[model samples]
Target: MNITVKFFSSLMEYLPRSVEGNAMAVQVDPGTSPRQILARYRVPDEEVRTVMRNGVFLPEEDRDQPLEEGDVLTVWPSIQGG
Candidate 1:
């Protein structure tokens, strides 16, 4: 299966340098979870503040759910601004 992963804000640094922009397309076996994808990319769990699958918010518990083909998993880090 194939899916698109997007990292936002400071979290974008976690993505590979070859990845253009903030998103990358990846191939994974069936039942691959968002958590596993983050781990594969060495994205620290603490750095992720939000997870969205195809524009729907995914709660922490649901992050481990299997991602379907063509799903877009977007993550964002905690942002601070005055």
Candidate 2:
């Protein structure tokens, strides 16, 4: 299955070189979920501060929420300040 992924802040560096800004498309198994995708993409769990599935916030406990075709996933990394 194919889905859209948008990473925020420092997470953008994990994206492909050709990926612009913080968004890109990726392929995954039919039953892949937000957390699974992150792991599959090698994104650190700590860096995944937020998750939005199709414009809705996806709770950590709900990581197994089924991903459908054309789903849009937005990932925001935790922000820190001195």
Candidate 3:
């Protein structure tokens, strides 16, 4: 299965290939969970502050949501206070 990932802030710099924009396409196994996807990318669990599936916010408990082909998952890290 494949999913679209959109990163924000410092996360973009960690990507292997520099994406001018804030998103990329990644391939995952069928029935992949959000936690599994992030782990594959080596993204620290704490760094992921927000999780969205196809433009909808998902609760932490729902991180196990199974991904489908062409699903887009956007992750945003929390910004610290000024």
Candidate 4:
């Protein structure tokens, strides 16, 4: 299946070269979890401060849930402003 992964803030650095605008469309196997995808991309656990699927918030524990086709997984990092 195909899914969209988006990295926000400082997390954009982790996106692959093929990805543009902090987002990418990639292929994933059936039953693949968001956690697995993050691991595959080597996204640090601490770097992912937030996770949203299709505009809905996804708690840390729910990252293990399988993603469906066309699902948009948006992840953000903790940011501090002075």
**lDDT: worst 10-residue window of model 4:** 72-81
The C-alpha stretches of model 1 lying farther than 4 A from their native spots are 79-82
Q: 1-68, model 2: which lDDT tens digit per residue?
A: 99998888888887878887888888888988888888877998887888999999889999887799
Q: Candidates sorted by TM-score, descending order?
A: 1, 4, 2, 3
lDDT of 4 by residue, 27-55 (tens): 99999999998998899997788899999
Candidate that scores best on TM-score: 1
Predicted candidate 3: what Cα RMSD to the true structure?
A: 2.5
| C-alpha RMSD for every candidate | 1.7, 2.6, 2.5, 1.9
Please provide, for model 1 over 1-82, each residue's C-alpha lDDT reduced to its tens digit, 9 standing for 90 to 100: 9999999989989989999999999999999999999999999888898999999989999988999999999999975679
lDDT of 3 by residue, 1-82 (tens): 7789888887776566756688888888899988788887799988888889998987899998788999998888885677
Clash pairs detected, candidate 4: none
lDDT of model 4 at position 67: 97
Could you tell me which residue pairs clash in candidate 3?
Answer: none
- TM-scores for the candidates: 0.93, 0.86, 0.84, 0.91
Sorted on lDDT, highest at the top, how do the candidates line up? Answer: 1, 4, 2, 3
Q: What is the lDDT of candidate 1?
A: 0.94
Model 1, position 76: C-alpha lDDT score: 95
Q: Which of the two candidates, 1 or 4, achieves a greater TM-score against the reference? A: 1
